[model samples]
Target: MTVPPEPEDRGTLTISPSVVRKIAQHAADRVDGTTRAERRIAGLGLGTHGASAKVGGEGNDVDPVLDVALHYPAPVRRIVGDLRARVTEEVERITSYQVRDISVTVSALLPDIAPRVR
Candidate 1:
């Protein structure tokens, strides 16, 4: 979904933000260390069909900015970093678009804390 450099006269058609989200989600999921932990669908307006657009010409470059919540068991920093790299690579490879940025938000940490019994 790479957008080609076009003339000013030709209006640049952009893909929907939701579409970007879906693609990001898919790409992230494909990575070994990442998963679709949670999606803040509220007010995001990510519809069921995803996003699509028609540029004036071929090679519509994909401009994506993803806000992802990645979950890790432990060693949060290392895991997160590896997950980020994998996700970025997958997205770029699969979509063939220049990813503006992939923001990894640490939503929760999965640690087996000892249960408290009174």
Candidate 2:
């Protein structure tokens, strides 16, 4: 996807990093059994909850690095494949920026738990 440049007289348009991050996080979350990991060092006191997205590359070509967690009992490979494709498609479609590369890291694996009855 190519982001259209602003008219010469109108000035340039810029996309915010936060926006890109949100897009990536949401896309990753859409995949079944996938959860976004919090931005924190492993074994640190900080809690994990949401994924992170980092956008890079030149011009309209943007690469996104996604950090996430997957629930146990799910097919890891399949979930990752879906995540990569979904994130790339959604980010490109929403931002109109070319997704040159998408890197997915499995930050953690959460165990499946049964719901409590009232």
Candidate 3:
């Protein structure tokens, strides 16, 4: 004979930090004005402009730091504010984890050299 499932509750679901980081990263990527820094390989720089995220969580809580490069003439505060909200919502919704806080770092402010098309 096998045991039946309980209706009220069951076991806990654990979401890892890396998973949360990826969630936050994706959310940040979706936002407009978010740019990534270059990746250098053997003195050769390569990589698309985008954003990177780091997440730390304790138990069911998570906090993330987003590093985004800025394209000149962009609205800074509005961009960061939007990025924070989006990351929080996605992390919580997908992982069912509480987002403690979000810290944003302005990695770089690139000159209006080449405008990227979204």
Compare candidates 1 and 2 on lDDT and give the better one.
Answer: 2
Q: Flag the better candidate by TM-score, 1 or 3.
A: 3
Instruction: Order the candidates by lDDT, highest first.
Output: 3, 2, 1
Instruction: Tell me model 1's lDDT, rounded to 2 decimals.
Output: 0.50
Backbone clash pairs for candidate 2 read: none
Compare the candidates by TM-score and give the number of the best one. 3
lDDT for every model?
0.50, 0.82, 0.83
Task: Give the alpha carbon lDDT tens digit for every residue of 1-118 in model 3.
Answer: 9787794467767777888988888899888887666777898978775778788768888889889887767899999999999998998899889999999998887765655775
Count of clashes, each model: 7, 0, 2
Per-residue lDDT tens digits for candidate 1, residues 39-82, read: 24766744332112111212444444434343346565676566
TM-score to true structure, per model: 0.46, 0.76, 0.82
Q: Cα lDDT for residue 3, model 1?
A: 86
Query: Whole-model lDDT, candidate 2?
Result: 0.82
Which portions of model 1 miss their true places by more than 4 Å? 1-15, 30-73, 112-118
Question: Candidate 3, TM-score vs. the true structure?
Answer: 0.82
Number of backbone clashes in candidate 1:
7
- Residue 30's lDDT within candidate 3 is 87
RMSD of each: 10.5, 6.0, 3.4
